[model samples]
Target: MKKTITAALAVFGLVAFAQAEGDVARGEALSVTCSACHGTDGNSADAANPKLAGQNARYTFEQLLAFQTGDRVNAVMSGFAAPLSEQDMWDLAAFYEAQTGTVGEADAELVALGERIYRGGIVESGVAACIACHGPNGNGNAPAGFPRVSGQHAAYTAAQLYAFREGYRAAEPAADARMTDGESMMMRSVAYKMRDFEIEAVAAYIQGLH
Candidate 1:
């Protein structure tokens, strides 16, 4: 029994190591293509494009897969991701996640209001705290596959929230597979409750995250 357990543990360790190695190797190779838009270190200089540095690997991977499979639709991203394999997506995500990110400051009034909205949802408005999943500092959990919102551009964040609220942004098909019916319902409900002003406030708060 002891020997059998030992063998099983050894196999598990080897599998884990192999998977990690694969992700790293693939991520580095796939990153070459991403450097054009995302920058060499994942810090995009383009105002229209969000920086990917310090983003959660799972989030990055999921987005890539979504674009490739038509779960998420963006003309540019769809074309870019279409040719990538699963390993390629994983590798690129790892590469971006390994990079460092920069933070920007928010205006005093905006910050104060943003903080109120982010930490305490508007009860009358039926909004929920952004911290429920994004964590207090906006450093999203790797396991949960949430992207890091801290230090993200306010404009970019606001745009994304707006898209989600309008149902213009669809869940990556891969992500939908993992989500339960309840999860989807909650997301739809929460998104519907967010107005443009609320989106701006939360985004401003997120920009201040360091």
Candidate 2:
């Protein structure tokens, strides 16, 4: 099973990877179950739930694959993702990506520190600027599959960052150990270096980013 999943991931052309893009209409139709946490339009109402709106389709699809294959360990997501076909994953990604993101209120107390961390990083600690990849507006790089962080829920972002820092996130298998698993490793390294306050502050800032 791991071999099959690994093969699919390697090519990005089997099962969920086969359909790189999907039908937005089909995705919308299939999102009924997701509406309880994420809104009908993919904007989540709760800060603890992630807002999928305007997220990169490829990145979203990768996550679905991770959840389905048990690489990522979220009980709620794993169950929902398990039954999804490649087309289903693709469609859901498309639907979420097509929706507009909803902005959350930022914690004013953390905004200044968060802004500095996000834009400049803690240079001495070797944390890199978020804008280098996430872009100036936090819209992210679509082709590179970096997710859009602008207007995401602060709590959700913080949780993910904490997960990465503490090694709760699943590690991607690298065909060559020498090769950095671009997305996964990059996030883990960054998160690992961030202090708890910096993580919270950055998440709060991202929540209100346009």
Candidate 3:
């Protein structure tokens, strides 16, 4: 079964990621401060930090914008994102997208549980399958702006999911509803419905997806 899943994922990769162009050299130069947390190669040494390696450029750019615009809030990220111009965001995204992410080992006991939630989901509870957007191997659907999840740190992933669940990504109270995108709402809806165990299990599954 696992072999079949792997075969299917390889085939899907051809169409899933739509690449973007940016100046890699400039991106590398601009990434000096980011290296403190994200590392020079986009792989953070800390499990709590997200690995930016092989991420979709547009997705990364959008996230940086989100941090800047307060669509997504994090004290540290907000400060880091404040000074960046739009071009800087794209360049940084390009550099990180060029790096490879490290795959993590899944806990033997949680592997099956994680796989179940990631692939099939808990329909009775209205939880959607992660694979629907993240793709079979966690490559993510770049054309649709979904970020890469495969090879991500479980701790980081779980934290984000929980944040969304708790309304961390909600638009500012005074902002127009139109400012909220459907994708963000969809993710928040899913997270809000998920149990703590589901978030942890799915995150574990994603770590080993590569």
Q: Give the Å error, residue 101, model 1.
A: 1.5
Error of 1 at 32 (Å): 2.8
Look at candidate 1 and tell me the lDDT of residue 166.
52
The candidate, 2 or 3, that scores higher on lDDT is 2
Give the alpha carbon lDDT tens digit for every residue of 1-210 in model 1. Answer: 000101111111112212232255556667787788778788877746788998876677667766775656677888999898766776777777777988877756678878988788778879787788788888886565556888888887776666566552445333223221123544446656877777787788788887
| Residue pairs with clashing backbones, model 2 | none
Query: Who is ahead in lDDT, 1 or 2?
Result: 2
Error of 3 at 52 (Å): 0.2
Model 2: what TM-score?
Answer: 0.85
lDDT of each: 0.67, 0.78, 0.76
Q: Candidate 2 lDDT, tens digit per residue, 1-210? A: 000111223333233344354778888989999999899999988888899999988778878887777556677988999999988888888888888988877899999999998899989999988888899899998676678999988888888887776552544432111112244477778888999999999999999988
Q: What are the models' TM-scores?
A: 0.79, 0.85, 0.84
Q: If the candidates were sorted by their TM-score against the true structure, best first, what order would they fall in?
A: 2, 3, 1
Ranking by lDDT: 2, 3, 1
Among the numbered candidates, top lDDT falls to 2
**Residue 188 lDDT (model 2):** 75
